[model samples]
Target: MSDRAVPATPPPLFDTAVVAGVGLIGGSVALGLRQRFLARRVVGLDASMDVLREAEALGVVDEVRISPGEWLREADLVVLAAPMRALEPLARELAPFLNPAALVTDVGSVKSGIAAEMERLGVRHFVPGHPMAGSERGGVVHARAALLENAVWVLTPTDHTPLTALSRARTLVEHLGAAPVVMPPAAHDDLVATISHLPYLASLALTHMVARDERLSLLAAGGFRDLTRVASGDPRMSRDMIVENKEALRCALERFRRQLERLEADLDEPEELLAAAYEGKRTRDSLPVVKRSLLPQKHDLVVAVPDRPNQIGAVTQALGAEGVNIKDIEVLAIREEGGALRLGLESPEEVQRAAGILTGAGFEVRGRS
Candidate 1:
């Protein structure tokens, strides 16, 4: 990204913006652009007429089309939200139609492959992006502007990419409520292999381990369910992501294997095993509440509430009533009877005010440890 600072009042980034493959990520981008009036017209392109109709019905886009045509020539911004395999082809097909000044980007998880393809194609304005925000559910029905809120959106710009184009892409990312992070495409792939791909495979492995025995499966509780949640995501999508970055993923798996071997060797040494567990806990505790750096810093308050109708809503309502805005939220634990929720606030002052509000409303509130 360029070093130029965005003015306090930046004009709309583009006159016409287009999003291809209007699925969860694509639809979310279209919605964000439309909601913020970042474009004069938001167009949705997909091979499925059904999807186009649904996006139109949901007001996710101002117009829908089956393919890129002459109108694409007017677009100042085009987001290729298609599958990883299809991105290169789609970019190639739309190249001749796009305005010379138009900025192009993608939401593909694996960046190195697409970055190389774009560089080879001489797509000067392209910026490869991966928004670290999504849900297990797929489709436009799950798309919403809030999905990208405070999320870290990574942009991988090749050496051929223009700085002005990168800056504009970053501006669009910020408008969608995401923090922009720039890094080499290879570095992005290597890092995500450890943080994302490996964890997903680990989730799958753990789920299979417990599921192999009916007795253990029947006893599975919240912790087991939470740990294996990613295994429940769309299997096809997971397969594609894992395979696309197999080289890095394999290296990550080898590192994990070594760690597991060390743990097994420490089984007979109780103190060593305990220390290993302690170190793991300390490292986990140091992760940011939200995955990025914030200026004022974010704080948290864990509120315990009964598992009743509207219980979660009541907690949020109480804080909202006190004008304490929530930055983010996560359910730490939930059982049939009750659960504890971790509410992220903007500052220590907001945390204090929120705690008082929830406690006044008859819910137990405590600061995050």
Candidate 2:
């Protein structure tokens, strides 16, 4: 079996889709569905009238509903894209309003608690999902049609879940240009605890520790800011995710603490610390890199460039001179020292050549292929 869910062209997967919250994630899902023509009519059901209006105005949804009862009955695919903590209560309120045949899923970060809540409420068609894509920003204004494109959209289903419901969820994921991976809810929570939740806590801890020191105000720069970017996301949502997966998070914290202790113990051993550092860089470099696509296909090449005039022009000129066509380019991030510039090429073949060209030009290239 393939490790990744195959992306298949989607037909009208559902007659209507009702996104529960029109925030960054929910709005993005609605936008993705509309872009793909996955739903004949897309509806927005959010508690915030302002958000619903904004989403509708942005064309993320075909129509806006003040209440779930207004559109819930007609919705064959319902996306609950609220925060983790609100899901249970939202489910309770939405349970009586759901169509018996409607396939319900969510875009929450943690799945175990949401899955348990779905089971507790006797929701047979519910699938728990966590899209491996987000930003420090929130709200409909920041939402994009390509937000979930080429990203991993994980769906966790129980053994009791009907295959049709599971398939429907997967098809929607594929329609959004995302790879769907199915797993048990508990496993999903455990994995994300280390990779997702723990990282947030670590960033927050770092920020908390460093920010209190007024002496480091001028000292902390590029590397420090880059490492702590996760701590800059919605604080309330981060806290909720951490608390919801505290059991798995506890285990992750213990492992992290042991690593920290080892580093402390090896403070005087320069070779040992250097070995640890190399191991980290090796592991990070081993992972597959997929960029959010602007065109139909994309291969991202991120270059670490100095913050000076003509640097971007020089990068583009190098590509032009090498006969490499640039499909798209973007400024991924900017630090106090330099900026990380991302370029999307047409094919994987262009990636290495571009990296080589930049490396030759004395640019620090991080090939994200």
Candidate 3:
């Protein structure tokens, strides 16, 4: 018996899907495609035979190859999950073997350059994409199909891109449990620079500044640790991302600098600093919650959980036993021996039921305000 959970009705299946560069992002995409039954076969391509072997052993791909070849002829879908700079070169090599109608996409963070490169190479049916999801850890061993769940997968399709191609990419995103968002390539690049790239840089800067003083770094607690956590991610990958999108990132940096300058100039005025902090808190809180496709907006319930070996597992198991489906979850805060978990449920009734269930289980539960 296969361990794979094949859906009763799979989405439009690709005859064969090719994923180049089987690292964290590539491995995750391959797993997602196979687990969702969106591809009849998932083939991994990487320059490293060692990486390919790991991917195959991990069941991230049905087959693995060190390079692109005639196998591309059978591929109806191709995902370039390599670094931003390598995407064009890899695409060039695979273009000839790919079927004329094959739909191609990428997980490259920066889309504008690749979009232009694909067009320059005359590669039709190419849709530049980026999934706003990943982990600090890298490698195939760390890849999980759940990594992309409820993620915002951005598809930056040019006007010249065929509707059929864009539709197919969206279908793949949906089947992978991601929400597809359409935007221009340049616009996508600019937006990610501010939200994604800028944050990484900020984390990197903060971590380096504090680490310069060992005693000071040793004293770093909750907020400081959380703020600098991203600095622990793959430095090579982070370097490539910020460099590839430097122009937009520079603009974002300048905007941030101005904000800092204003705050610094008003350091003597405590009220001004407090007001600015309040403004930031309000803006951050007002950011719209992510709603997965094909599902109603989720209602949130906050549960205060005591720190214990299996507190989270116990809560999940208890909810599972009651057939309560948690659409999403987040660890809101942690202090000393306890923390709060926010659970997202389908309906208000489910929220109420979940609150009562947890409360009955001796947990302090509260509905979102």
Worst 10 residues of 1 by lDDT: 3-12
Tell me the number of clashing residue pairs for each predicted model.
Answer: 0, 0, 0
- Can you write out model 2's per-residue Cα lDDT over 144-232, one digit (the tens) per residue? 75678789989999887889899988877876778899999989988999998899899888888887987875777899899899999
Off by over 4 Å in 3: 1-12, 288-369
TM-score for predicted model 3 compared with the true structure:
0.75
Arranged by TM-score, best first: 2, 1, 3
Question: TM-score of each candidate?
Answer: 0.75, 0.76, 0.75
The digit string of per-residue lDDT tens for model 3 on 1-369 reads: 875322122232587999999988899899877655557789999999999988988889989999888878888999999876788799889887888889999999999888998898888899999998888888988887667878899999998999999998997887677889999998999999999899999998888888788887678888898888878888888898899999999999999899889999879899999999999999999997765333233487656666565677767877899999988877643444455566779889999898788877777665532
> The CA-based lDDT of model 3 is what?
0.82
